[model samples]
Target: MSGLTGAQAADLTPIRTPAAPQASFVDWSGGYLGIEGSAGASFGAFNFHETRVGARAVPDFKTGDATGRSDRSRSATTAVGGLFGGYNWQTGPWVYGVEADLYGANLKRPVASTAQGLGYEGVDPAFSVIRAKTDVYGTLRGRFGYAFERALVYASFGLAGANARILATEPDLATGAVSAARRDLSYLGFTLGAGVQFAVTEHIALGLDYRYVDLGTSSRFDLGTLPGPAGGPLSTQAGFTSHQMMARLSWHPGGLTLPPEVDETAPHDPDNGDTGRFSLHGQTTFIAQGVPGFRAPYTGPASLIGNQVQSTTTATAFLGLKLFEGTELYYNPEFSQGFGLSRTLGVAGFVNGEAQKAGAPYPKLRSNRYFVRQTFGLGGETEDVPDGPNQVATRRDIERITVIAGKFALGDYFDGNVYAHDPRVDFMNWGIWSSGAYDFPANLPGFTQGVLVEYNRAAFAVRAAYTQVPKEPSNDVLDPRVFRRAGTTVEFEERHVLPFLDQPGKLRIGFFSNVGNTANYRDVVGLTQAGVFDDINDAAAATRAARRKTGFYLNLEQAVTADLGVFARFSNNDGRTESLSFTDIDRSISGGVSLKGSAWDRPADTVGLGTSMNELSPSHRAFFANGGIGLLIGDGRLNYAPERALEAYYALSLSKTLTLSFNYQLVVNPAYNKDRGPANFLGTRIHADF
Candidate 1:
């Protein structure tokens, strides 16, 4: 698919070939694969009607009447991610192609509620809710474009289809109990869009595009009769239109087959000295987990259901740019989908580290981390730094001062252990991988804005940070108040030699203080017990004010031999207040051993075993005993005991940058409720980094 003539290749000399024409320098004539992320809004309307009325139906209720249907305007902001592939045929300045893409998306309309029922319905304010949602969609399109040197401007039109659903949750007026019903649909329509793409390298291109999709009105779906005497069969239909703006990155393998002489002169030559200034790397991880049937005396809103399977997937891209000496900027954008078993509830020491509080059926695109780092080097011994994600290769003095500001995860800098820190390649249990009681400040995706400063030396280091906390307990939104409501953390690190085994080891001690709009457990429980409120949770909600939580953690990692290591952690927090972030554990202690495959044969494989015991403070236990719920766990009434977890895993290396791990976890006294279960979890993880 050369865009140039045969005569042009023979006449070009090695030295002057670098000055070739734009068409030959960057080819747009081959099959390409791409990943795209989009964020925009969806607009729609849903119409609801009662097809049949029962004996106790109100006189004012009209079935299938022209003006009786509940017609509500619907709208929502949406986020989506997906993949595409296509082949392009380029003839000089003109190019033609056909492309198809499929996406998992979160496009949901707001809930429309019906007016309350009449007095004789025997229910207080009985209501019904209706909503429309789209989970997956795709487009099959043909493209036409004009090549402007390194950029291509294109337009496309095609057929579109969406997997949509209409959901309803209504109260049975006679019993005053709520139930739900849903109808799934496939909508076929049309799509059109235009975009511009620019070649960043011979094999890579970046683009931005906008599209408008129409999923025509859906057919009426009849939901059978409701549960109570005053209820009736229901039906609904909706029409949807969405506008999306997407960013894309693609790779073309055909560029790899270019003539060696020409390839060396391309912009992304491996021998270029300036290449180290910019770094781009990516990783994708998938984890599937399941639990078998277990014994349970009762189940609550947050109880883990037995005999269930679930999975989660995440894809992340890390991009870094060095602006000047000792200064760099980095961004990490990620797409995540799926949920944990029981929707990430039940277990106090959760089995999946990658699962977040917010779970979705479709992929959601988010910028999880963006930060700027500045380093000040002091004259001393120099050290070499190898290139990796978010880190550029360079040499720096052993003694230096580093400062970082912007948004990131607090775990990135604190309570880290070499043997158990990363869940993607190593352990998968939250209690084993992290200081479970630290309660670090974070949003739903486990990220927050902050500023950190560190002083490093050959043998020791000191670091501190000031960050934003959640606006309220267990909330995703961060508080803007820096001084009034914020988080501050400090850590001290010491690298030393163990006299017993003559091995190297590191020790870290961290302290954290967080101030936020949280309620006190004792206060809420007292209000609930005094007949002032019906539930402890509702009482706590009404009593929230400024409160402070403090905690500390100790982390240690030591090497026992060339192929073996051991790590441990101990963390605790004052549990008088409600949990602000993280799990429900108020005190935790964990330890583990990790062995490398060098012990046997495969040097890249590893095996690990860990155990943890998590406990809730007395007051925190009383809160749950009174039917209060924290972030991840609460089982209605208390059979209070320390939650215990045991985890083991074997990670088999498929390649230098890929691994498949098998994991197992045993959680006794889940959520610290002894009457519940000794649940067992089985999991598998596939991870890749490049």
Candidate 2:
């Protein structure tokens, strides 16, 4: 409660000029919605007692002794975040409220295994592992508080709930083969906490909060058949307690306040007083996809199962603030969960572009992008910029210089295609949405820190950027060595109008180079063939050294009519060294057509159809034939053929901000193996934006 006051000095600074300070009294009554993040530690104890079978008693697995009782305790530090909402009532200096929140937590112990150093040597051991975790928890609380000017002190008492689980994996007693068992319990208890908040603006407040929670002892849970000679059913009881400290930022829309002004006759244009200083936007996308059985002669480590269904969900908040004239800062915080089909393997041209390489068992919060953008006008015609995600409404010169720095996806700048750019709304195939052969540098989530500069004129634009790559292929961490291990890219774009049809079109050419610790496909293959290593992956690891990879791409988009557009991309890489990021593609070409449904009186709807072909280089194919696996695709042996995909989708717009799409894809020779299948996939996507 000790931060700066006044609406003008809040985190989101306004863009207007000259307003004397006013409003000394603050009001704290409203319904509020916000995000809260906490860090803390949890401590708990578990007691397990074996139950005898008809003729035998289970060995005390927790300990080597014969005693049936096993008691142990564990503590873990964790970080949790989620959404919170509540309403408060204020009378004089007293304020009371009731609040509820749910959070995904990483509170669990490491797996305890009994097979350490036994070197059963690649054979399945007749041993077991035990572990316990709490994945999700929430609370409903009643609060009481007192307000002093712009600050509030409060105390809360609540009921807390958690889903607690224990997992035990072991080998079968009779066959000495692997088996698994699990038990789950729901716990309910109480929580108590206190906190303070300082109102930074009439509708926004920043606060720090603390709470202590206790989930009382659980009833004995019975875990099914244990695996040893004395195997039997096992019962266990556990209790949980934790303390957390959280930072919160809440918006009281119900108590909205407007700045003092007297401009009823002002023009609503950028030169006048129309645009706001800050913009808030959000989007959520959920995709469900499935594949039926296909012809597969044999499966390898990265092979996609015959039949499977998977889903992924992502939600992001786009917050932008004007820092100074012609400059803005934007931050995008996202929550991602779920998995891709076959754990995102077995496909060079993956079916789902939205599927991330990293999967999470529960929703995880991450700051995916945060950056600053500055624009300098170069004395030319002005154009209107609409309000949207990461962009605020304003009028800027058509010819200008812009500089952007921070963390973001390179695709956001390069590979421009109006008909096949956004996967959530358009094409869903990676090869169609982007140039598959260009190994753009990125971490697992497809983002990197960099500086980008662009020069724009009425008919052309030139862009360049230098960005960080991952520490290793498909790694989640970015390398910090800048020039020693980074990526540099440059692109030139030309805008034109077709003479015959009088339709507009654009052509883009881009070149990229990356320097990193990489291995040559031919070198690694040679090492494996000489018997220096049994595995091609191990040979590649041993041969990794400073190497360079380069590529280029050509992209074009043309509007044929008022309601129809077409796009195409052709890209190729050197294919000498191993792929550092992106997928296993050396050369690719894709084309697509998009049509608006205005002919059927549904102008907001869209239909698209696209096709792509991806090929691997000769040496790259030989490496895979020797059982080398890249980031996404390898099937032990190669019957090599070009990976081809055909995709079609129809999006039905439910409203201005919501859409439902149905998609179908046919993949020929999945992962470029002629012996395998022409796989078919069906998918649905629900997308919302505001």
Candidate 3:
């Protein structure tokens, strides 16, 4: 009935056999890149050889005769970190490779002494001081190793190089004259090391190594004519040696096929391996500006006048954590010092947006930004988000809804321009960076507590926010009462793909309103006319009450090419009341262009040009005409004119992490007063980030 006989049934029965066990050993051959931290002691010797020739032909002093010499030795402990890249090949039990590495450290020592009676009649003594420092070093090495299972022991010998600095100070005791010289030198050296590396997994390995390096000697010489026997040549020599121990973690791209037991615990994505749930990042910027012209006829408590040099420095740390799925918390702590040009007064469109009106000789530390953001996905296409400061690498739906609450800058969510937003990286003018007349809500440092919600699709997005305003005009403290007195903004954005380069462009329209204690400009002017007070500020202070100010702005950014982009912003506010926050700008229009220097073979360089025009309303202009000062700019008597400014800058990228920029600005009718002037400002900035 089954259609099978006894012999056929026997043939149909299956025979089972155990599969052969998989190999236990891993193949350790491939190219790898890693970062390492090192610590150790550096020992070095400095030899100073000095030859003095006589200035006069006499019995006691002869010309071209050797006079003095000195030699010294010192040591210092140092810590360093850097990157390493190399390739390895393994055959049988032997492994060989070539590797290169670079490191930066602070290894310094000071050598100082006094030379007695070195001058003609023993009446003059000279003091000499030298500080020797080694800042950066590198190595190119060949490695030979023996492999046993998952571990390897290796020996390396390499050619080494280092950058050294010698700072010398020499002072004459008789005349109290001092001469200083700083020399940066590069030295060639050699290195020897031995290390052991063990594979934590097929793709990751941990290594510990010790190296001894010897940097050859460098010499400094000076020839000059002096008053007496010391008029000759002086020479100094320096040498360096160091012993360093380093720990390294490396990833081998070609050796990622791991056994099942190790694969379960290994990192899923090696490129972003360390980016788990928490991340930290930081940046520092220092800018110095000098204004040559624009001196006013008279000065007020807050006025820009005369020639001045001002500098500002800020350091910030960004800390972020993922609380749960689709939710993240971020905190930014910042420390800042220095003042803007003219204590951030005089010009309506201030030259430095990074600077604050409040001046402090010491650094002031504050919590700049603290916020929580949560995203709800609406099933759609996916997009890849890159890792950055306060951003984690992940995938997100193209259509989503996001809600953010807590303290942050309003500009972070609204009124963004591609070519001109961050003063730290792009345009440095307050008017150019944002919609000047919009006067979004904020305290002294340009941030506030708020709640923002955003909805995004493939080519369109809308955002709205309600934020706290300062307790009073230009105050550093917020009102804290959410509904009683507050500020609100709504923005609509459209993104398009341009036809020329398929590049994206964006247009945003925003409306804002603030309700708080403010004075009417027209009322202040009328009170001053009625003989109540000679000063408009006095009249304004006497009539302070709750009022509302509303404004609107339009922002546009378009990419013309792969290397060129342009941006424009226009804004206006009802000038019935005094400024609640930000600079004194009632109406403004600004536009700019940014070009990458790829056409000239300097791809990392950028050039920018921009212009801004700002105007005051009828009531605001009348108040200033009657000797009223509203925050930044007021001349005693007013010859009112629109404030106009043009700015240009070139930024050169010295390295991937460092940038140097030179900028210039020309301003006409500063503070909206014709009497003030056409001012010129020159500035330089150094920015570094990690």
Candidate 4:
């Protein structure tokens, strides 16, 4: 529960080693399933060779490190499983054989927490989670053969290569493993196979085969997260498929032989199909305060809720393609931005180029957002109509359509909150945005199924957007009784996702709005109130209002448990108003928790409601359970019309990327509040997700 400090053992001691044991594993031992059917059936020829084991899962560095997380299998076993074996030589219409193998990968770890801000003794709040293992043999593979066994089948060809090691472990208080990372990855492969086997006699036989593994290279990692340092884009090429139904009892004593020569090139057939894929992509954060030339005195106060700067670094590259068979083409790019981002105190400000530094007005911008999307659209499988083979309707599948435009900000098109992913709402990360999304497949789980229609099948999706605001004036209504002074505001969003009513996590009903056209500025006379700042700096000139906005959104992400999960969200906004009201508006409701076990993995919990409000989270008050709407005292602002207030926090899943928090916030500004004690109550955060 405590370890790593002395400046984190002199900032990670020249990369320490040997200290990986939170819970790790990876297994392999040759022979990845073999076959050779026919004994009491009606078909002959098969093969077998299978062996796997992948271990190196030493999580719980906290609770649920990051999200691609997976632990809990301490008994369900298989830490990214793998195994391989070789041999297959048949003879009849003709056949051949040859093989060899080994496999394993590095999950990675080297974190030391508690340094997000606010200060403490060498940073109170500790860290530790080790389990680093590295091993990767010749990683080589080979397969050669031929066969025309049944009435309609035969073909296989393969080539393989491997040598891997990418490990890191950081946890030290007394010679543990300060820091140690190793990298060396390589893999080249090709395979194509077709199925049809039916033999149940002299030996054994069964059917169903499909093989397509073109590990050409495309699955690189280094995330980097924020601005400069983590590393970018790396993914050779990937296409994996293995749906086999086997049963082979062969006694290769010298009866069926032939070992060499075979190359059935269907280069991944289906009209030369190669819809490549290899993903491991990656951000949001900020903590800058009072700008103008740095006054540096721990200046605290003057917040539009949050974003004392915060642009949160940046890096992303989500790529995957399969343009046919229901459609799929998703490519998201941002290449690189700031690695670990440090403009001194944190924050990039809403995101667009982040809190200007290297020369203002728009300094660093590297936006690469590409799109041609379809995950499932267009379906009708039954081909044959040259003259009258019957079964019409050729190729009419268009269930996926995505067009993304970016200068940035629509929550970067895809990554939390527009319809809400989890915390974030502009701060000078500024302008430009466009979006489109699609999802389908359902068969009455919650009483609705339509992705076209396949009886008992249901799944649906929708998203729309427009973004670019923040030229200034949104850090707390900017005074003037609070109505309109800042600039740039026009946002619209919508979402409808529902499935899994039996409950496990799946529900979304969304709506968000904003419309602020302010800039005629000039008001403050005779102190009708607003008193000093030296008498409102010479008050005069005030009305030119046209700030109309609207808002609504709700989400429920399910997966109650493979380990644990129970999520919920609710939002409300007035955007500034020309219409709709409950008093200018700002409402919230939240509750969260998630966890997986073994050493525990994938743990998350966000709780807030009662007009809930979140400020950069990791653990905002132990997953706060709803709170925040308004009216708590004098200077307080009861959200204007309706005045609601209740906030919450509760985060626990400490590992993979770390998060241990607890906070409770309730706000009102009739100007400043008239009652209540310690500002009303609870606060804490021990967060991280990298």
Model 2, range 501-612, lDDT digits (tens) per residue?
A: 7999999999999997889999989889999999999998888887899999999999999899999999999999988889999999999899999999999899999999
Q: Residues 1-690, candidate 4, lDDT per residue (tens digit)?
A: 989878878976797788854211111111224343111111111010110011112122234332213232111100122344455543444334444334332222222221112122352233212122223322233434333221113455565443434333323434444554444556565645443332222222233233333334335343111111221221111111121111222222322222222242323323333333322222222211222222122221221222222222222334544444434344444311111112211211111223222211111234334333333334544222111101111232334433333222333332233212333211111111111011000010000100111111124445554432221222211122222421122222223333544434455554544333332211222232445323221221133244544455455555543544454555544322221111112344544444433333333444333232322111111111111111111121211222223444455443323344453443332111222111222333322222
Q: Which lDDT values do the candidates have, in the order given?
A: 0.78, 0.79, 0.76, 0.28
Quantify how close model 1 is to the true structure by its C-alpha RMSD in Å. Answer: 9.2
Error of 4 at 655 (Å): 39
Angstrom error at residue 53, model 3: 57
TM-score between candidate 3 and the true structure: 0.62
Off by over 4 Å in 2: 1-268
Better of 3 and 4 by lDDT: 3
Q: Pick the candidate with the highest lDDT.
A: 2
lDDT of 4 at 628: 15
Error at 342, model 3, angstroms: 1.1
Cα RMSD, model 3: 15.0
Going through the candidates in order, what is the number of backbone clashes in each? 0, 0, 0, 177
The TM-score between candidate 2 and the true structure equals 0.71
Report the C-alpha displacement of residue 178, candidate 3, in angstroms: 34
Error of 2 at 41 (Å): 27
Local lDDT at 356 for model 1: 86
Q: lDDT score, residue 9, model 2?
A: 79
lDDT by residue (tens digit), candidate 1, 151-205: 5768888988888777767766557677888888898889887766656567877
